[model samples]
Target: IPFSSTTKYQISIHAMEEGYCLLAMKGAPERILARCSTICTESGTQEMNDEMMEICDRACTELAEKGERVLGFADLVLDNQYTKEYPFCAEPPNFPRKNLRFVGFMSLIDPPRPQVPDAVERCRSAGIRVVMVTGDHPVTAKAIAREVGIISYEEVIEAFNINTIETLPPNLPFAKNKAIVIHGAALRDMNDQELDRILYNFREIVFARTSPTQKLHIVEGCQRLGEIVAVTGDGVNDAPALKKADIGIAMGISGSEVSQQSADMILLDDNFASIITGVEEGRRIFDNLKKSIAYTLASNVPEILPFLAFVLLNIPLPLGVMAILCIDLLTDMLPAISLAYERAESDIMLRPPRNPRKDKLVTRKLYFLAYGHIGLIEAMGGFFVYFAIMAEHGFMPMQLFGLRERWDSESVNDLLDHYGQEWTYQNRKELEYTCYTAFMISVVVTQWLDLVVCKTRSNSIFKQGMGNMVLNISLVVETVVACMLSYLPNMSYLKFYPILFRWWCYSLPFALLIFAFDEFRKWRIRKYPQGWYRKETYY
Candidate 1:
């Protein structure tokens, strides 16, 4: 019936053994009740003494320091037979089963995969913390943590070994600034209040000799102090804390069914770098979303002002409905879409993590900067083009006032200019189309200038450079598309015609004016951090 005649097993598993059993119950300080064995040795059944106990302890420490999971074994003395209490693996139904000899320990090391260190560094740059919890010797846990950048590799190894500390500091637990390694037994002794203090203050921490319940305790303690927690696990034991974390990340390839069921997300490759990539991508998307909104709003003030002025002042319509549609739906769309391809700000990782309570997507500063300042400027520039064109073409700005009613009359084609020149319906329509083309060119050309300014909230666009390929290509595409909308003949839907070469020359100064003005505004904001302009307009 027996495969090995000399085998006699004594085992107790689950939380009580996996978490609490120490030294294989051989040298542990528990009461003894039975003495039995199936194997006999020549050296008087393998004696348990001080030297043998030392060897077991040394074996555990060595394995742990090398990041190994050490298992314990014990020899049972054969003097009396005992009834089996636990099934599968049995032990005598009594405390500290009698006459146990300390058999040496064995270990397993699951070497960490490559790229984990770089991923951890990225998390640190983004202001995320990493903590290690393991049911292994403190030395072993500390060793692995150090290898992974969780603990500094340059840290003196001697400083981490607590027992070797011939002189203890006043704050015994936190003497080392680089890292603090806690033993599981010592952690079990600490109350939640003490745990919270350590977690709140320490920059680096390693929790060793932890049980399944201790890991749960660590997650709960961090949460109680208002920290967002994310737990990673692959075993059934990790299920409880995985479910408790704000974001539970499970290893897909190696994870158990229960862990997969509990996790908020799973990593198919099981590489920690994926998490860092996610953080980077998420931040990039949020910044681009804000950029697109700001860019879209910046032009709306100018587009809508033409109608408002016509309704109130009754001036001849400077911009018709078709012209507005060409600018809004056709010419301006590409550049606004291009804003979505902007790269992350240069200091995106260097800045402190944004405060969730204070930072926001839209704010008074954004509104004032986008609508009240840039938008107003664009509106004024558009109107100036209309005024300049009319003034030079034999009509003063004053003469165009209150002309909306007559300008719209189908039969009124002999409208006279300041030079006493009568114009037929066909001739006046050509002049009107010329003005419309000038207005369209003004908005399109000016918006390209605005796009450069919109690239950064504060920094110089030249300093950031134009390496974003999507945005660079979109710039080329927008230029071509806008040219077609304004210059190509027979654009009946847009009521547009080819703008004169002279109008292009006229627009150069206005576009330059917008760019120089924004540059000056940026300079003042940078030079005077507390200035009112920077405070209200630093979008």
Candidate 2:
């Protein structure tokens, strides 16, 4: 059966009725057997022979022994067959108060996971607070909450006496003004009074005597104060509240089918530890998305640098529209996709949650790093290309030259002829070498710089030993491929100037120089305080 607890009860009952021989049952084993056998009936079976009677006797003895050892609860089914025989009693037995040592009873009567406490504490460290809400009595709730490290053992588990909210303990110190133990009756009747007080004035609060409706109300009230609520539920009654939360977390293992359907995410193990896993996943997703935005903006700026320079210097655009499309689609796509899979930085969860209102383009310090460093690298590369040509001409080169350095009178016309040929037709294949080389140098070096910038804030900037071996290897491979690509032959039609195959080899040092400059910038930003690099305007 999907509900193992219910299945165990049914199985145990059948075992008891069949007179199955008992071996050893204690603790969880005993509880499980008892719960399973609760529905079993030995009433109309054959008359108890010696062996049968002995089996029954053993079962009875075991039940009594274990009953005193654990908190046992059973559903009392009344025999409606008999009438009340006109007997009336004036007073009922008064259950003792001190005997109520149960701090909290979980509504989830399912067996507890042994690791809930450790998992909860880890979440607390990640800046996500946990507060337990259950229909169980205050004593039982408190016990579990303490065991799970959600609350301390010294605090009293506050409970309202029945439906009356006013019956709560008077002159309560408010336990840091958070009412760590706010009963469900109070939560439902107070119209967000305790909730608003807690959200505004308290650090944390634990709720008890909560029904599904009350749970939903609490979630809504918390959201009103701008708190993002992740509600976890696994039962039929929990479906409505789970649907209402900002992030609905459902238990996949023990959760009801309805609850799982309503939830945004289902925890595979039904362990509280899985909740922590989900939060980590959310953080990683957000981080990778931020990286994508940073990478796209940085990448686009560099690709467009030659064009921007052409506009500024009143020169013809070195790259045509098709060339821009080719580079954007081919050269830039792979590395940007690679950035999406960048491994989580060591401090991903160590920091607090990013504000939802924070803009990926504007608010974060990473954006500044992306624009400042990336723009500088692009401009430097373009300047070198322009300077290399100018130096070759002695002043300015108006005449176009082939790979063999022979002059062509119609320089622009010859360049257009080269652009319209087979080399251009298969630009992805031919320029695969050059474009990829440039892109490789640009991205890998920039990302490494990005790593430095990210780590410096955590005082990790000084830790040069922390390097990603895989990223390092990928960068080496990219550099070697780019270097070898420059020497590919048969390039006369591709350019008016001599194909500086050796320039590909030369670009490597510049790439490394870019990396060093980025690191220097990070250091300068920290060491120089008010002055480092010039702030460039960006969207």
Candidate 3:
């Protein structure tokens, strides 16, 4: 190529400015003056003899065969102004471009991340298949993949590669080995059906020399096989594939803006281990959401049953409407919110992902748990407080039933109690307000245990610990709020009265009962996951 025709230019040593012309430096001595340039491999190679070339070729082959990256070395003799303005013009005088010297070659290896092997093993243990796709040469790709545990260090008999000539293989491998390495050239001509077939069969794979479109096709093919694909990339060319994936992960430090914008997740540390941490964290969040929802819903049964009984049995309402509002908006609210901060159960990542079609936030088992089991028990606790207070003061449990009309009356002043005390309408009305306060306190107390139970769905409370300081702080706040709402002076608008502290203490055992019962249920569920009892009772 002519000097002007050459779009790019490079330095040369042991050669003149006029293309290897035999011109010596000024004031020549035995030692060459290398003031303006440096001695490097490109120069070293040209001066090297045929024997040296054969040695370098062998060294490079050995290094490359071991999957090490090689960099060629050559000698570059320094020169003055001539190097800066070296003439590439048609051989000035009698010079020709030839002969230089070479130094040696270097083999470098970029070691894999320290945590990568462990993370890859964890993914394997979780039954998650990981595939590596890169623009590197096949040897380098295979080496890195093996280091990261994506592929075992074995060459399978039915391996696929760039060597395949047909657009589709004459007969696809049956995938007994499960590990296959494919080049971008092999995938470039593959139709979607062929892509799907290969991906659907192989559990472990590597794609080398892939273009951006080939990567996008791989992601789409995975989705076609109902796989939840997570594509990770850092380049602008990777944006399309990242967007096409089910979940896209972008490296925050190394990623291009287009890829980061297209991705659903960002790895701030640009480490493969961070993705595993993210997966664990994501599973915890989902489990915590379910717990928060279940705890929030458990309080509803106790809240609604009071009104149901009042309307049916004609008793003065055990819990007032405003009190229900207080339980939902005040005492119960923070505990439910605190559940979001709870840590995961022990086996959060050990189990497979719950099927989207089968597992739900509100399942049949959850409904039975909230409204039938725990809720039924809590509702009984509330009524127990109500009846116990009414009976002790004057009225009997049976007499209070069917008494809503006379108890709430403006005219009636004489209601006979089982203790033979004749109570006026005003006195009876005050007692009814006290009952509402007791019911509210009952819910508050039981819900504290509910919070603890909800900390873990299946794991024992002892096993998970009351995780997250927020839960403890919220429970404390719940207790104080319940006390203030029940006994604050002149707070008639809230329909709460200063009830006896004895009624508050009376409800403690029921809360303990709830905690013990839930712990037992958890044990049963864990011990017998496939048993009919667990299937029927687990939420």
Candidate 4:
């Protein structure tokens, strides 16, 4: 017979000169021992009495407690008279399976991989509960779980009273510090509510002698408690749970095709340590993505505020439409993409798993930091440069207000400046382009500081290191591109114009201010970790 979760054993028959002989029955020790009616003693087969059964059970328990997987073996010899009545064929007639002679026990030790203990410790430190579910006996499972550090020796001692609860109660006397080991037979009898209660009560759990169906139930029970579960398996019997879990990791080397197909991810090396590496990479990517988003969004205010000023305050547009396109597509692209290459600011595995519901990629605090804080300062920088350039050319900030209609009019050949200087349309148009260049320069400069400060949310730039070569190269490229857009000939069609070197110098203070302000914010957050400043402003 083939091995199954239900049968828990396999049998084979052989042809002998005397008759057909069933060579072996190998499976769960208890299941195989239960089917035997006679025991093979030193002299001959003897009736299996309660005393013999107790001795066999005790031996199996001892082996299992020693962290060995135990299997029982039994066989029977049939005479010619029995085979003659039920002749052997491709499909042999059913023969009596009872009264078989019980064989001695066999045990094998399979130690866990060396790195598994450290990986399990990392999971625990990360606040991820590691549960072991296996078809092994309860004692064997508990022993291995302890060896792997899933449950400590002290927890096992505390939970020894109810180590194997045959029946679950409405209210378990489970303490928060205690760990529990449950038998699969008891799990089979548990309803959904009782299973949920069991899962809720135990932070560390071990499920022994579990069937495929029981594994699926455990996955469902965790999901019902709003926990995100990731299950790993390598056998066909594991496919159901693998499919049901939020994330299913399949072992490529030993895993069945069915399990791999059902899994969300595959571990090619089949090492458990790879899973911790993946978690660290995932957290780093999430942090980098947030940094990229914040960097990208902060420039939106500087771009939009110029147009807003043109419409509401009736001032000449500080930034042109083409300039906004250049900022988004050219100067900002490389820096944002380079954030993905940034190394982790800290040991990401030391932090608890982020709450999916409460902690998001983009929060209100992120928006406030991007638009209201950093972006607001960037917009101010752009406007300061715009007005300074305009004032130098005889158009005062106050005089530029409510001048949009006349400023853009094609028919107005001459316009009066604050100094009463007359300017034709072409002259004023060149001045507008200069102002556009000035504002774009201010945005680009301030964002350089923005990118540096955004690299680490809680760590200072000096501590985080300015060592992302990709980002450093991107900043150099941004400066080159900005210069090209400003100084390149025939670029006026894009509303870009060459500005004096002093205009570049004017935006430097604002850029430094951005760096200084963000550094101060990070310092405050680090100094007073539990303060309201961190709660409200530390995005």
Highest lDDT: which candidate? 4
**Which of candidates 1 and 2 reaches a greater TM-score?**
1
- The per-candidate count of clashes, in order, stands at 1, 17, 22, 0
**Per-prediction TM-score:** 0.76, 0.63, 0.77, 0.91
* Cα lDDT listed for each candidate: 0.69, 0.50, 0.75, 0.87
What stretches of model 2 exceed 4 Å from their correct place?
Answer: 1-112, 152-179, 316-326, 359-367, 396-477, 480-485, 492-539
Model 2: how far is 3 from its true place, Å?
Answer: 16
Candidate 1, residues 1-539: lDDT per residue as tens digits? 11110122334422232233321332111111123222123565555555655555676677777877565555542222222332323332343454555444557677787899888887788888898886545777788888888987354323333343323343634545646787666666677877776677666788865667888999999999877788988877788889999889899999999999999999898988887777777777777777777777877888788789889988766776787777778777877888788888775554445555555777677777778876777777678877787777777788888877777677987878888887666765666766777776677777777777777766677776887777777667767876787767677456777766677556656667667777788778768878987777764
After superposing candidate 4, which stretches have Cα over 4 Å from the reference? 41-51, 84-93, 157-173, 410-414, 523-539
Residue-pair clash count for candidate 4: 0
What TM-score does candidate 4 get on C-alpha atoms? 0.91
> Taking the tens digit of each residue's C-alpha lDDT, what string does model 2 give over 165-193?
34434333543433356766567567566
For residues 418-490, what per-residue lDDT tens digits would candidate 3 score against the true structure?
A: 9788889888878888899999999999998988988887889898986589999999999999889877787
Q: What is the Cα root-mean-square deviation between model 1 and the actual structure?
A: 7.1
Candidate 1 vs candidate 2: the lDDT winner is 1
The candidate 2 region of ten consecutive residues with least summed lDDT is 97-106
lDDT of 4 by residue, 280-329 (tens): 89999999999999999999999999998999999988899899999999
Candidate 2 Cα deviation (angstroms), residue 493: 4.0
Deviation of model 3 at 439, angstroms: 0.9
Best of the candidates, TM-score: 4
Which scores better on lDDT, 2 or 3? 3
